[model samples]
Target chain A: MSEAALLVESLAYEYPDGNLALHDVSLRIERGERVALLGPNGSGKTTLVKHLNGILAGNSGSVSVDGVRVDLQNKDSLRRIRSSVGVVFQDPDDQLFMPTVREDVAFGPFNMGARGEELDLVVKDALERVGMWELRDRPPHHLSFGQRRRVAVATVLSMSPKILVLDEPSSNLDPASRRELADILRGLDITLLMVTHDLPYALELCERSLVLAGGHVVADSRTREILRDTDLLSRHRLELPLGFRVD
Target chain B: MIRPNEDPLKHPISDHHHGHDFGERLVLHRHSIVHHLEPQVKILAMFLFIIVCVATPIHFWQAFVVYGLLVLGTILIAQLPLNVVARRSLIELPFVFFAIMMPIFGSGERVEVLGVSLSRLGIESGASILVKGTFGVLCAVCLSATTPAREILRGLERLRLPNLLVQIVSFMIRYVNVVSDEMARMKIARLSRGFEAQGVRSWRFLANVAGALFIRSYERGERVYLAMLSRGYSGKLPDTGHGSAGIRQWAQGLLLPVLALLVLAMTNIWMSR
Candidate 1:
């Protein structure tokens, strides 16, 4: 059988200060599946996402992206995992560090050893996908928050990763920009794992939702079903918008 | 002041509407020949021109005049406004002040000009400093006016500047605005809580703010590093190919410096005769 797009088994992590951030967090995302990771602040969503790209190696268990295991000690495996699992950070400012948007988008593919026409095409395609091709030459500081977010997505998308993980993609966006980003994400064919506190956003974007609380997978079910479970959401500290009906 | 019904994050109180001005202040985007020249050539030409200006003696005032004229002519050709050049040259005001003080305080042979006593040697040396310093500043301003900051960094890289230093400078340029914006937001938050800095008594609060800004910036650096790693950045940054200058382009770019050199040579010949 073909491997799952991402597989995390009994993964656990602890910070340098001995703070146990995640424990026994096992999950599997099939290819092309859109999954929302719902949890309160400090519930280990970011930790899990970091493990997917081998940014933070788990103390125990294992993480595999596109069937390749994430091994921090193995440089080749780490590179392969990073390219296969693109993580779009919450702050665009952190991700888009290049002087111009075009160069920033090309940074990833260039590191992957792409050059000349191949690099140009990858940059062009990524920007076009995010509707940022017109503003390709502008600096990141000049772009609006929504525009920067889209460019941030493109920076990862340029690598053509098998799975795209977004942390708080809908945060700090206006209504129109929020809808626009949703449309863009919906159009993409890659597997997605969005870590968000925006419950409505999760319901709109993902078919499945995983609820994590106190370093554990408390719930994993359909997004609508999870949203409908008010008791479970309150228990996990996940709150929807006031008067947001799940019917 | 928070607007009603508007998302405060969406419309930051310290909105950077003039953020583009930070870059545009130095680089005037235009289709002029000077702006089109390769950045390395422009950088080299500016360095050569400054070197020649420094080498020329103060006695060669005519040569200085010609050098100034050459700069003015290039500014005209580059379509840069005379006022902008003059405004940027105001950065030399402190040096100008020091030069003026030289004539007043020097202990050399005294001379009187319009009821004012000045040392002859001090007058000559002061004039030299004024002329040389002005020429250096003008050349630098002209180079920056024609080339974008990114291009200047690329030029430095091509000129064999150490990769680590270049990356450090590049990151500094990119994050200066971000760090400043973060500070501005923090200030607004403080103001909203009715906090105000009132002289020495407020130093504690201000120091706390500074400390907070430092921590935020440090954390931001870590996140940026992680982002770089995610994109496959190893110890070294990848090279973005920049086309080298052709012979003709080099000749065109070096014209100003070469002309300055000729002016110096002619001044020497005339003085010898």
Candidate 2:
């Protein structure tokens, strides 16, 4: 396997209210590997991912992206790390905050100190990558939910992050849109860490899966192996579709 | 949840075939000469006009006439309709009416107008106050109608307004429509469920709605901040690609402000003599 692109060592996090969200969690993702963080609701998956970009600091332990430590003191480094790991949040409404689509996509490049033709190029290239060039002038609020989600991804992609972190990439999507999203993810070679409750989606897109239960890495195995373990899935409140065959 | 017909998330229906342009239907015609002027110029011109109008004594009929003419000229030059200005200006008219009443209630000479006894100085000052306030309101309306909100914000930023205030205004303008739509949908949902509160007790229902909206907005804010950070948003907002005004553009923008100031200065000199 390629050297670990991300390393989290004994990561522990507690909410301000003294609720322990993550406890002694440790995982490492290899370069160019797509890792699905499978979990039930409130399983600390988000808290763990948030640490990747230094959005939330772990109460104990450390997160290192590409071997560089992520912390508050190295904020400039954190900014670079954040740009390197583009996060597409679950909610497109939250992601696409600008009045127009082009503006929203341009936001990232502009923040990265891209100006003049360089910024224009970044925006154009990113929009084209997601096949949203035609909808560049449209306001994001006016787009269909799927389109907005694609634009949301494009907004982060504009920054040219090495790792694309997505939260619930397929939630609330129509089947066609979900398939489209899956296809989009499959085509991209970037290291992907997707947090999802969609078991089938996780199986299809990721070769490896890590199941988190009670803030601990309970299962780490190949996608097929995890899917085949029916008893293990039910224990964590996760299940496969009835009568569904795994290829 | 995807209610295509009743989707609160649906974009406002666009009438593409009618040749209805976003700027053309509105008083704010994009790309017009007035529209392209620097924001500071527009702001300064408006300020000078308001100050001159307000400074003039209430009995100076000529001064009010000049101010009205200047406002009318501004509207014509902006190519905005009078009706639009009149309707929007009403936002502050009630407040101005209350202020103007001060003169009527002040202790001074009593007079009769159309056989109704009224304070003479009160009547005079009230008329003057009304004209001053009306001129100020007109000037402000013209600023908004001719200039797009984005440009106005840029102008505010250029004029050294508090950065926090400018950012707050920009965010408010961008999100106000979305928030309003959310409120409208909430109202519809409430109505469908047979919501009815007829008295002071209704305030609690309103408060609940407000609280719910606040929570939703706050959650939305958290998500937005995360999205920003994901895209490498530091503390500062990125520039919108509208750089500083060019020399020629700057000169062109200064033209109107200089003319307005000159006219005001001349009027002040004449009035003082």
Q: Residues B1-273, candidate 1: write the lDDT tens digits.
A: 332343223223234332334444578777888999998899998899989999998999899999989888888889998898888788788889889988889887999989999988889999999989988888888888888777887888888899999898778778877887787778778779987677567668767877997899899999999999999998666667857889998999999899999999999999989
Q: State the C-alpha RMSD over the true interface residues for candidate 1, after superposing those residues.
A: 0.8
Clashes by residue pair, model 2:
none
lDDT for model 1 comes to: 0.89
Tell me each candidate's TM-score.
Answer: 0.94, 0.84
Q: For chain B alone, what TM-score does every candidate structure achieve against the true structure?
A: 0.87, 0.79
Per-residue lDDT over A1-247 for candidate 2, one digit per residue giving the tens place of the 0 to 100 score: 5447788899899999999999999998888999999999999888887888889998899988887788867878988888888888888888887757888999988888898888889989888877788999776656888888899888988898888899999999999998887887787778899999899999989999999989999999998899889899999998887787676
Could you list the iRMS of every candidate? 0.8, 1.7
- Model 1's chain B yields a TM-score of 0.87
Residue B120 CA displacement from its true place in model 1, Å: 1.2
Fold similarity of candidate 2's chain A to the true chain A, as a TM-score: 0.97
What are the runs in model 1 whose C-alpha is more than 4 Å off?
B1-20
Judged by DockQ cut-offs, is candidate 1 incorrect, acceptable, medium or high? medium
Q: What is candidate 1's lDDT per residue for A206-229, written digit by digit as tens? A: 999999899999999999999999
